[model samples]
Target: MTLVLDKLGLARNGEVHLDGVSASFERGSLTTVLGRTLAGKTTLLRAIAGLQPIDSGRMERQGCEFGLLPPWRRDVAMVYQQFINYPHLSVFDNVAFPLRQRGVPDAEARSRTETALGMVGLSDFRARAPTALSGGQQQRVALARALVRRADILLLDEPLVNLDYKLREQLREEFRGLLTSQSDGIVIYNTTEPAEAMMLGDRIVVMHHGRILQAGSPKEVFERPANVAVAGIVNDPPMTILHGRLEDGRVTFGNDVGFPAPKHMDELSRGSYRFGIRATEILPSETGGVIGRVEFSEVSGSETFVHVVTPLGEAVMQLEGVHHVLTGSQMRLSFRPERLFAFNADGEGELVRAPTTGEY
Candidate 1:
């Protein structure tokens, strides 16, 4: 089955929620809708489920218009960010509720409920109430409920966001297998996390300010972000954007930092350009030319993300292992000229050239 959205737009009280959003969803494929909070991820999903009205747009499923259909008449199931399961219902009954409501045979409901529970690793907890289960277990129950319906469209709106870090990671690993089992349905998962989106999605749709920024495979969007907004969204610490000039076979940032332009940029005309570099690409070195003062540092897992104020602009350096640097301390950094992503200096900041990949 194919679900196509054309020119989806929604505005409320003079504030736009979704602006001219358009995309196609295919069955057996999982699309992750990625954006920050209030980016309209939930609004889009609600519109698909017929819970929210659109100001303008058209939705077709297999050439049939379904945008105007009532929520119950649509073959859709949604899982929210919160653990939305019935406290009074046992895990088994909670999962079977949808099938029971549809008047499926008792025997068939039992079989489908058990299968869905088993897929989410909640079979052992089938007799337990939702209130008696852990957060992860409760979420599994919610997921099983959605899965049992086997709706034509499954929408998950940041369902794992409320769990703790370790639980989120564990469930994320399990979700890919569980969701993919619904091969006949179109799955759309929403998230604010770039890593989760990249890890779980077959295709990713990036949204910003209610607009679709870019949509493609994780690698395509990561390697060649459509614009500065996309680059900011896809990277964890966000790519460091530097306004620089490429002139006389040399690339210069600020007043003192300069290097010979890499061969990949040889074909381009020398002028003003915006350069982007990943935090991981910048390294601390004793002989490094670019010196910056550390503004702040964050240590996540074994990696340290150091924010620095350099002459060119603020840049973040992602370092392996934890290194404690005092705020205002001087740190010398270095990066290869070839690793920079070149973008047009125009207002839109379109990508001009991306660094060569796979060699490093």
Candidate 2:
């Protein structure tokens, strides 16, 4: 089944919330919507679920059903960021609540509840009250409730935001796998973490200012962002954006900063353009590149991130291991022309050239 929206807009209390927002979701694939706070990610989900009224738009399930139905009758389940569980009820009871509301028999409801808890690895804690469980366990109980209902569509709004890092990582993986187990269902999630979306989503939908900036596979979006905002969001530590101009087949950022432009950009007029280079693409060089000073170095166990101040601008470089690169050390950084992404100041331009037939 598919969820369709046409020119959806939502206004609340005299405030224009969403403007001409349109998106469609297909069955059995995880679609992660990435948007910053206040960008209407949750609002869009709410509108689609019928939790909020649409100011002016049309939404429909593939069968043209759900024309006038509340959320409970629409077969759509949602999990919020906070764990909203009944403290006095056992995990089993909490999971069975939805089934009972639908008039399922007692034995069948119990069986479905057990199965749902098993999928989330919470079967052993089925008899415990919500208050006795840990934060992660309570969240699992909430998820089990949604699964027990066998929802036709699942909408998750930052569902793992309250858990710790290890639990969050594990649960996100499990949630993705569980969503795929249903052959006729769709799962739509909203998240701000690019890594999480890259890991869990089959397709990533980048949203900004209530509009979709780009939508593609993780590799496609990462390798070739559609705009500056998308390029900034897809990478960890983000892509370093520098202002420059193309002249004589070379990109000049400042007085001493110059690098050969990739051959793919040969067709563009020799004028101004912006460049985006991920931290992983900047290699530490002794010379033959732009000279810079290490303003600071952040060393994690497996890798070190160095922020360098250059005549052109501040550039962050990711290097493996801690090689005793001290702060204020004189260094040079080189750019990988193939790894660089270019965009125009107007925020609409080709991020990277498409690969040739023999390249891949």
Candidate 3:
């Protein structure tokens, strides 16, 4: 289904929740609403599902108006961050609840329920009670229930937040495979973490302060954020942005360090600017442009984030595989010119691509 959120506005207790959110989800793709807490990700999803009444704008699916339709009336299914299941219902019954309510034949409902359970790897738990399952298993059961409906629009509100890292990683791949292969439906997922959005979304909407700040592919947003807000909030540890000046064809930092300006930035005269680089892209070497001491280091599986306090400021470096980054050890960091982003005084960003740059 082509799900479109048209200028949606909502409020609760006299406080604004959704401030004119307008976006569309194309069929056969996953659109991730990426933002932090209280950024209106949940509110936008509820509004699209018709659970939260919009004060102004309307929800449209496949050219049909949904302002007057209730949750059941819309061909939609939602899996919340919280795992919700009927305690008294068996796994089979829970998965088949929607089909039963729609009065589907017992044989067809059974077939569909079993298929959904199998997709979520819960086929063997059909006869078990919801409470008898582990938290991860129960969340999978809720996902199975949502899938059994075969709704045109599938809404997942941070569905994997409660799962352990290993399981969440496992399910992220599963969700992308299942949802992206569909040519007749779409999945709208909300996430507060950039890593989650990068994994699950074909398209990502960067939301902030109850508004969508930017929308693009994961690579586009990650490599080239729209503004300072997008740069600050999209990453796990966030990007390290240093305010500096564009002077004499070079961008000058706090220390006596400078780098040649990119093509797009050449037009502007020497003035105030902001330069940023992601933690992962900060190349560390024995002798580099910026120097700092290792303040902290953490290892997770094959990845390591080493915090360094440079003359400019403190920044985290994401290194692949585990490295013995001893604390208090001096470190030197350098970055490719194209890997850095240059923003004007007004906060508008210029996306820098390797061997080329563009003013966005």
Candidate 4:
């Protein structure tokens, strides 16, 4: 079912918010909503689920039944950041709560509860209280509850944020696999972390300041961010953007740094443009296109992030393999023209294929 959130707006007290916001999720695909805190991500989810009334705008669920309407009545289940299990209740009872509330027969509820717990590998802890469990286990119980309901549309709000990194990683893998198994439905998850969004989402909806900046596959958003804010958010080290100009059929970065202008950019009448290059595109070398001093280096075993203080500005590089370089070291880097990105000063971005730049 296509879930359309059209022109949604909301207000609370005297504060006005969400001006004409709209987006949608395709049936059966994992569409992860990405944004910073207070970007209206949660509000958007609540609006779609009909948990919060809107001031104006329509939420259209094509062909959905009304008796199947209300939050409990709809084929939807929400998993929150915190474990919402009844601490006094056993895991089994917690998982079975939804079924019991729905008035499912005792025999059927027992069977489904066990199945859901088993799916999350918590069948062994059925009788254990949530307070006795680890944070990860508690979250699993909440997930089990959602599964027992056999929801067609799973709405997850920061579901893994409360767990530690190790537990978060483990749960993320399991969650991805579990959600993947149910391809007949949809998983709409919200995440503030770019790395999590990259790993979990089949399609990413990037939001900033309560509006969607861009929406596409992981590669699409990463390689072709709609603007500078998005470019900085989606990548591991983020894309390196520099103020520059496309003049006389060439793109120049400050004084000595320049590249042949790709025909796509050349065709544009205006000469002013912004330059963007991913860290991988900037290789360290003595004879490369640009040279800079390494102001800072963050080496994380398998990879490194080098912040180069250059004549133009500081450019961050994401490099793989052991990093032997130290801060304050002079480094030279060059990027192929094709790997560079061109954008208008207003923050509109476009990817230029090597030897040719293409407009978005």
C-alpha root-mean-square deviation, each candidate: 1.3, 2.6, 2.9, 3.5
Of 1 and 2, the candidate ahead on TM-score is 1
Per-candidate TM equals: 0.97, 0.90, 0.90, 0.86
User: Which predicted model would earn the best TM-score?
Assistant: 1
* Candidate lDDT values, in order: 0.91, 0.81, 0.83, 0.79
> What ranges in model 2 sit over 4 Å off?
12-16, 63-68, 293-301, 322-331, 347-360
lDDT of 1 by residue, 43-87 (tens): 999999999999998999877898978999888999998878888
Residues 1-360, model 3: lDDT tens digits = 577778988888988888888888898788899988999999887887778888988777767787678787887889999999999999999999999999999999999888888888899999999999889999999988988888888899998888878888888878887665532588889998888899888899999888888899998887668887898788877887777788888878876777887665666678777777778778887664788999999997889999999888888889999898899999998865556677665635544322233422
Q: Sorted on TM-score, highest at the top, how do the candidates line up?
A: 1, 2, 3, 4
- Looking at candidate 1, the ten consecutive residues that score lowest on lDDT are 351-360
The Cα error of candidate 1 at residue 121, in Å, is 1.9
- Per-residue lDDT tens digits for candidate 4, residues 155-243, read 99998887878778777777777876744677899999888898899999988767788899987887668777787667657678888
Rank candidates by lDDT, best first: 1, 3, 2, 4
Score candidate 4 by lDDT: 0.79
Return whichever of 1 and 3 wins on lDDT. Answer: 1
Predicted structure with the largest lDDT when compared to the true one: 1
Q: Among all windows of ten consecutive residues in candidate 2, which has the lowest summed lDDT?
A: 351-360
Per residue, candidate 2 scores C-alpha lDDT tens digits across 1-360 of 788877788777777778888778888788999878777889888887889887787887866845357876777888888878988889899999989988999999888888888988888898899999889889888988877777888888888888878888787777677867743588888998898889889899888777788888888787778978887777777778888888998878877778787777787678877788889889988777788899998887678898999887899899987766789988989987766667885546546443232332
